[model samples]
Target: MPLLAYWVTYASLDRAQTDWYLFWRARFRAGEPLPTDLSYIFLHVYETLHGVGFNRPEAAFAHLQRLWRSYRVDHPQLDHHLVDWLADFIRYYDLDDEVTRAWLDEAWVHAHGDLAVHYWLERGGGGEVPEGVFQHLISYRPEQNKFYRDAEDKAALDTLLRRAVVLTDSFYRETTGESVFERLKTKATHTVERRAFSGAVFEGPDFQYTVATIRQYRQDGRLSKLLTQAVRHAENLARKQVGFRSLLRDVKLPANLAAYLDVHLAPALATLQPPSPVQTPPAPERPRVQLDLGRLATLQQESEQVRGRLLEETEPGEASTDLEPSISPAVPATPALPAAPLAAVHRPPLPAQVAEGELTEVDSIAEVLAGITDAARDLLRQLRNQGWEAPEGDLRLPPGVFTSTLVDEVNEAAQPRLGDVLLQQQDGRLVAVDDYRNELAFLLGTPEPAALTPPLDGPWGALAGLLSPLHLEVLAQLLQTDLTLGELEVFTTARHALGSAVLEDLNSHALDTVGDILVDPYGDPLTLEDAYRDDVRRVLHASGLVHPE
Candidate 1:
């Protein structure tokens, strides 16, 4: 109908008295070929008929069947949408007659049985399948359905198949006196060959695959061959160290087969043993030596007396008030020892006092050393005694003190006078920089270290005269070990200047003084050339930048 005539007819009709079926039927037949827009209108009519059709089951089924057949070829998906409707119709109206059964079978075939299968599985696969529905499901082939061939659809189908198998197995067992597999195996003509096995039954790899495959075979009514194949495959895989116990836990089998498999496999499982663990021998304990406290105190007093006498003798005519007299008045005073010859007394150079109340470089260095805490001083003494390097744990520090923080404190205290950091941490140990070893010892009142002599003649002597404190410090660091750019940065002036700039300045000084670049400026880790190492050390020692080991 044209839009004008269609609306005119709809407006003229008394809705309560109008026959909607005949009205739509006339509209559908008016156009020799139905208009495409009328298809939705026809579906609406079908829905209306379905909703009201239950009151007259025969009349509704006949009308829905005629509409379905008329539209099914052009609208194949119409059957998919009608699956639940048809199922409900048959179930609600109790329509199990031959005519209704034939119509439902044709519908199932047209819809590929996906919705029909889903409908039954949704109901827990219980109750009797309406006539023809079971036959269609049993005869349904998944490979032919393009929808089921898709990956997602295939997974859904597998889930449905598993549920169906479980439901069928449960129902069959409840209805009959035996399991599905037990009844199916009665027709087996061949015997299952037994094999030697050392593992428990159903203990193997790919157990899920075995279980799923067995379920599929059960659905296909082929359990007789499946049981024999599963046992043989499990035994073969067990020989290669795969287990099969997971399969039996997931898949139930006939009791006779279970007992037979257990009898053969359990003996081997019992004989298997786990490997023993290896044992290690215990380490020997170190001996502990206890100190005699009384003897130690006496020795310490005598040592203090000897040190006071030495200080008194070294600084003649200057009363050494640094120590109190340790000798007891109860004992007679010992005769004063004869003074040593002047040539025998080797006094280290002491810092000169400033008259203007301003510290000179030497006084500043001394003051920095004097300000060191007893803990820091002890740490330094240990490092010096251990050849200037000791594991951080071996050095005694107060609780809650970190070695790096202590090193930074000492270095910061000395930087203005020393012109560089004096201590470094390397490879988990505290190290006194070599350049300040003797200077530190002299300040601490320890014996002076032996002088290390390197050739200072000719060009080397000139180079020594030209090097600055910072330049000498940089060379000394490189001499000990090659330094990365970041490590060299610490020695740069103010510790903020670029390492490359420091190298350029040093190279310029060397090129002017000795006519050679003493260190490689562009190496990945900067290195001092071997030929110039002796000359550089001689410069360091000449300027008192480094001390002998």
Candidate 2:
């Protein structure tokens, strides 16, 4: 119809040529004999016949017969097309009769199928099929499962099939009170077995598929790319190791295909071998981070500023008195009558500060300390909530696993390793966010503190029951080995924190250990400073896990 329309509109032919083209087309459509004048029109009619033939074969057949009658003798080219179309019809559907036989005898042999024979069998209402030609009609093994490249994959498939059979057997026996295992086994063995390329079942290697079809099957959706690669590798292995050339001798395939597999495919598969076992991966190296003592020093300075502010707030009335002596001048008593102007004098209110909930921002020492405390606690809670536990005894974590509230400069400059303490900057002041000393001691690998006191029932009570975090850390280390005074000082930053005030606090908690350190063996008591440096170490070791060696 479209070709007819094109000629009518665009050909610009005379009225006679237009009528002649229309007459032939109309004659073909009307099932009338095509005029002898337009003999070339048979080819165009056959092309149209093929387009509409698959569903309406009877109408297509009428056109086919007419076309064949017109050109089958002289125009063998048109006969070739007619034979090919008939072959397709025979392959896909049931057809028979003298007309079918005539076309079947003229069919072309191709890679596809036995088109003529299949059509004859279907059209004759089915009969005994000849030995090898139409075996795919009964049951066909998909090219995907014909052969496996991987031995492991083949084994897995076999296991799945056996399990499926067992499950089906169990279901049938329970439901029907009869075991169908033997019957199903025989049926599966006969029907599911793959046919050899030559149509014999048990005459060739287990795999009978062409590499071309295998490649196509591997491109399918269910198989992953990795699986496809493995299959390809297995195919290569089987060709070399399984004696593919020797196996191909027993089977039948196209000469070209067999030659390609042996000459091209065999060499390719041999080169693509599995990896060697000797090469092992190296262990991963961890990143390093530097701790910033400068940040801690700045925090200490901010703490001192906060302390000064707190002292002034506590004695607000004395603030003016303290300044009065330095002023050396005072306001006269005459100012009492000029109170109205003094009251009217505009003193702009303090600039509004950023607020969060009920807590408004304040430029005071106490508020600064409070902010530090809140930030520290919030950070600690966050780390804990995110599964960062306070490990006992020398915690060594990966770099950046636990984050600190330090400024970007500090964080970026160094990668903080495990066992490093974290500090946060709050309101321009740095404060300890987590206690690393005891946490390190409590880590799984570190030594435990001497259980001097009775074991506590809870995590907090246990930590609080022991010596302070610093002392606990010292004890954990000392338990492993004794260290000289200089070595101990170098081992930790806590040595600087072990001043008289801290010693006194420790003495209050562990009175017996402190009392023993205060007195000398000669009955004279040592000074607090000397006692801390010398006697305290001895006394602590005697009381705890550490013993002088």
Which candidate wins on lDDT? 1
Model 2: which ten-residue window has the lowest total lDDT?
A: 186-195
The residue ranges of model 1 lying beyond 4 angstroms of the native Cα positions read 1-373, 377-455, 466-497, 520-534, 537-549
- Clash count for each candidate, listed in order shown: 8, 15
Backbone clashes, candidate 2: 15
Each prediction's whole-model lDDT (CA): 0.50, 0.35
Q: What would the per-residue lDDT of candidate 1 be over residues 177-255, giving only the tens digit for each residue?
A: 7654455632212111111110111112211100000111112335423443333322322322222111111234555
> lDDT value for candidate 2?
0.35
Best by TM-score: 1
- Quote each prediction's TM-score: 0.21, 0.17
Residue 380, candidate 2: Cα error in Å is 6.3
- For residue 545, what is the lDDT in candidate 1? 62
What tens-digit string does per-residue lDDT give for candidate 2 at 303-396?
7786676565555455444433332223465644544532222222333752221111112212222323333334434334323333222223
